[model samples]
Target: MTSLPARLYRALALGWLASKAVVLLVNAVTFPRLHPSRPSLRPRVSLLVPARNEARALPHTLPGLLAQGADEVIVLDDESTDGTGIVAGCLGAQVIRGEPRPDGWYGKPWACQQLWRAASGDVLVFVDADVIWQPGALDAVLHGLEHTGADLLSVQPRQRPVTVGERLLTPLVDNAVLSYFPYPLIGLPQPAASMANGQVMALRRRALEEAGGFAAVRQVVLDDTEFARHLKARGRRLAVALGGPLIGVRMYASYPQSVAGYAKNVLPLHLGSRPLLLLSAVAHLAVYTLPWLVRVPGWRVLRVAGLLERVAANVISGRTRPADLLEGLLGPLTPLLALPVYARALRRTVSWKGRTYPQKAR
Candidate 1:
């Protein structure tokens, strides 16, 4: 007979799994997805890329942006040691030297503020330098913004994780969004339901100005979500969508880079509360790991449910890689691998792109 404590744990695990299953069911239909649209009624667009030591990445990503038919393409070389500015200029983008980030400002937000000031377009598209903009990507995003009547549209570009470590960890990023967020609430005008992806975001210039622009989130490392929340709080229209083949990003090249990259955002995701972070780690281990290892009640059922949820998440999020479905089966291992990330995020500071920022819950 199962002991009382064991039975209780089983109940909790099964309950959590069931909750995620329900979320997946809802998001399957309601989640917005983007596909390439024919350019029409074109608004003046300023394509902005914030690059830091991204000389190598610019060669692959910048060409796509330049070909997007934007009124102007601008790349801010954020004091990169690697000839980021020169490469962007050669690629036919108007390169701007970013001013040094002021005290109490995070690097990306500071760089973005400079880009925002320089842009003279009805639509402001902020894209990371590492993203690959497939043909018609910008048009589709703009169409999404206009169709939804949103002031800001944040897109989760399809992830292309090639390495073993990347395959293991990267798919989980979409899982968090696809399996948790209440999709219906996302459309409602409320800050609590807001979400955003910094990988690719398109904003109307007027909406950005009303929301106080990038300066509103200058200090926080998780600038995207905070900025989205700020916009939503001020009654700005917001939308989140999946970028199918139209946009792609390989955010980290190796296992270690993936670990460090995730660590920087993990604490911020938990709102910088040590107790909350600790609780999350323990909950993930219990909810994700124990269901696979122990032959407890409903263990096999839980495993199958978890895998299906993962695969469904991939499909719903527009991840087209065949490997992603296989990686979905490896979803249970993500919590175990993310243990190191959780540990690193517990520190007082985190580093990214040669800059270290003090971590604090705002």
Candidate 2:
């Protein structure tokens, strides 16, 4: 017989699994479908890309951005030693030199501020240099913005995890995003509930200005989420959508790279609260990893949890594989893999592109 404490634990785990299942089911049913309708007001759009040593990836990605049919495309070179600026200009982008790194400001934000100054468009679309846009992406984004009447719309581009490490980490990263903001609840009048992906974002010029533009979030590590929060606080409407067939970004080429990328933002996410970080890590481990370790009364609960997590991953990632869901069986290992990244995030002051910023400084 299971002890009272064990029984309670089982109940909690089962409850968590059920909640995940419900969220997955709801997302599957409610994720917005793309019905292409061009905006009546086709605001002139400026496409802004921040490039730093992205020469290898830019050639593959810049052409796609150029083909998106925007009014103007600008690539801001952030002191890249690589030929990012030259390659971008060759691909028909108007390249601009980013200002020198200023204290108390993140690199990407600085590049964005420069792009804003150089741009002359009513709508501004910020895309990372690594993002590959599919045809009709710009059209779809404008359509979504007009349809929702939102000041800002951020599309969680489909992630292509080509490596073993990426496949393992992708689901966890995607799950964290999905768990934070449910798709259906976006546009609700709650300031604390908005979410965004920095991979691709579209914003009305006036709304960007009203939210104090990129300057408002200059010091933020997770500038995308912070920008959304700023818009929400200003009572500007915000929307998030999956960029199905419209965009994709390969975030990291290898496991170590992926871990480093995550470390940059994980600590900053908790807003420097060590206790909150610990609590969140524990809760994530419980919901995402503990099921496989505990011996529940039946395989039914385990199977259900596995299936639900897969469904959630598929919906969030916009890719379906029987193998993908089966992969949830390996979810117990996620915490172990993420632990080192979390530790590094907590202990180290990360230096990116020759500048050092302590994790605790914020």
Best by lDDT: 1
Worst 10 residues of 2 by lDDT: 294-303
Off by over 4 Å in 2: 33-37, 286-300, 322-326, 360-362
List lDDT for all candidates, in order. 0.87, 0.77
Summed backbone clashes in each candidate are 0, 0
Score every model by TM-score: 0.96, 0.91
lDDT over C-alpha atoms for residue 358 of model 2? 66
RMSD of each: 1.5, 2.4
lDDT of 2: 0.77
Note the residue pairs that clash in candidate 2.
none
**lDDT for residue 7 in candidate 2, whole number 0-100:** 76
How many residue pairs clash in model 1? Answer: 0
